[model samples]
Target: MDNPMKSSFWMLCILIDLWPYVEDNLTQLQCNLFSIGPGEYFRSLVAQQKTHLWTQRNLCDSPNDAHDRYISNHLFAQLVDRHCIDDRGPIKLFCDDFRPQNIIVDPTTLGIKAVLDLEFTTAMPSQFASEPPWWLSLAGPDSYLVRGLTLDHFVEAYMYEPRLDQFLAAMEQAEKTHPAAEHHKPLSRLMRESWRSKRFWFNYAARKPFDIDDIFNDCLKDGNASIESLDEETRAGLDAFVEAKMKQLKAYDTDCARHLESAG
Candidate 1:
C-alpha cells in the first residue's frame, strides 16, 4: 500500500504523462486545458448514478429529502455540464482510479511492480488531467453524499482548506523536482487554478455522478437549494423523470429478489 502523502508525488508523475497533446507551435509554458465534448457525458452519468443509488437502497443519509436531492442533482447537472464542454480539448489517456490501492510494489525495495484496474482507463479532455487528485488529501469526492452528509456539515471539521493547501504545495514541489520539459508551464499552477475555478469539483462530479449534489451545494452555489430554483417546465419534467425512475427501480429490485429465491 502507498501512503497518500508520499504517493502524491507519484500522482504528479502520472499527471505529467497526462499532459495534453502539444503541437509544434507550442507558445505557452502553461497547462492549457480542455473538456468533454459538449458535456453530455456528465449529464448522462448523473442519471446512471441515480439509478444505481435507488436500486442499491443506499439512502442511508437523510440530510436532505430524496426528492429534493433529485431536484438538486437535476439542476446541478445542467450547470455542471458546462464545465466539461470544450470542443477544442485534446484527448489524453487517463485512469480515474489512479490511486494507492491499484499500485502494487515490492516490499523490500518499495518499487512499483504493476498498476491494476484499467477497465475504465481511457482518453479524456486534457483539462481533466489538470484536476487536483482526490487522494492527495485522502478526502475523496465521496465525502458528503456517501455518508448522508453535506460538505457544509463536515468541511470545517476536516480543516479542508489547510489540507488542500498542503496537497497543492506538495504538488508544486514535485513539479520543480521533476522537469518533464523546461518549456512546459507548471502543472501545480494549473491544479491550483482548477481548484479556484471549480474545475476540480466539476470534473470530479463528472467522473463521480453521485457527488454532483454535494459539489453543487457546497462549491458551485450555496444555500436556498430548493426546487423553486428551477424553472416550471424543468421542474415538471423532473417530477416525471423521478416517477418513471421509481417504477424502474421497483422492477429491478423485484427481479433481483426473484433471482435470489430461484437460486435458493
Candidate 2:
C-alpha cells in the first residue's frame, strides 16, 4: 500500500499554533453568517441592490487593504472552521496530484551523514514561524509555506488588546500553578523583553501578506520543475475531478438559496 506520508502526497497539516479565541470567534461568525440566522440579514444588507455590495460603503469591502486582509482573514477562518481552534489533533488533507517531497533525518546525526537523502518526496510548508532544519531541502524540489504562532509580544500589540497588567497577573498565577512549566518565567519579565528585539517582528512578518507570496515564489524558483513534468494523464484527471466538484458545490449553493427563499 502506498504510504500517505510519501513524496507523492500533497498534504495539509494544521498546527495548533494560532490564537484560539480569535480562531473561535472567526469560526462562529462564518458559521452564523452562512447559516439561516442573523447572518442572512447581514448578508442581505451588504448585498442589497447589488450596487451596495460593490460600493465603498461596504465595511467588509474596504478598498485600501481588502485583498490582503481577505486572504489573511480567510486563512484564519478556514483554520478555525476546520480544527475547532484547540482540539489538539492534527488534521491532514490528501492531494493525490499535489505531490510534495519530505525530508526526514536521523536525530543522532543532525542530518550530516548519508542516509537515502530523500524519501519519495513530500513538501510540508512550515508554518509562518520558525524554519524547519536544513534537511527538508533535500527531500525534493517542492515548496511548503512556513507558519507558526505569533510570539506573545505580537499578540499583545495588534491582535489582542487586553489590559497588559491584567494579563500579566494571570500569567503570574499560571506560573505559580505550573511551577516547572517552560513558560513559568514571570510574565512581567517576558513582557518587558518581548518587543525589545526582532524575535516577534520576524515572526509576524512571516505570515504577513507580502511575505507569503515571496516565500511561494522562492520555492517555485528553487524547485526548477515545471507543471508539465507531472504525469499528464494524472493532471488531466485532476482537472476534470476539480471541475466536477466545483459544479457540485455550485448546485448545492443554488439549492440552499432556493430553500432559504421559500422559507422566507
lDDT, each prediction: 0.63, 0.33
Provide C-alpha RMSD values for all models, in order.
12.4, 22.9
Off by over 4 Å in 1: 1-66, 104-114, 143-160, 174-185, 245-264
TM-score of each: 0.62, 0.21
Error of 1 at 202 (Å): 1.6
lDDT of 1 at 77: 59
Stretches of candidate 2 exceeding 4 Å from the true structure: 1-224
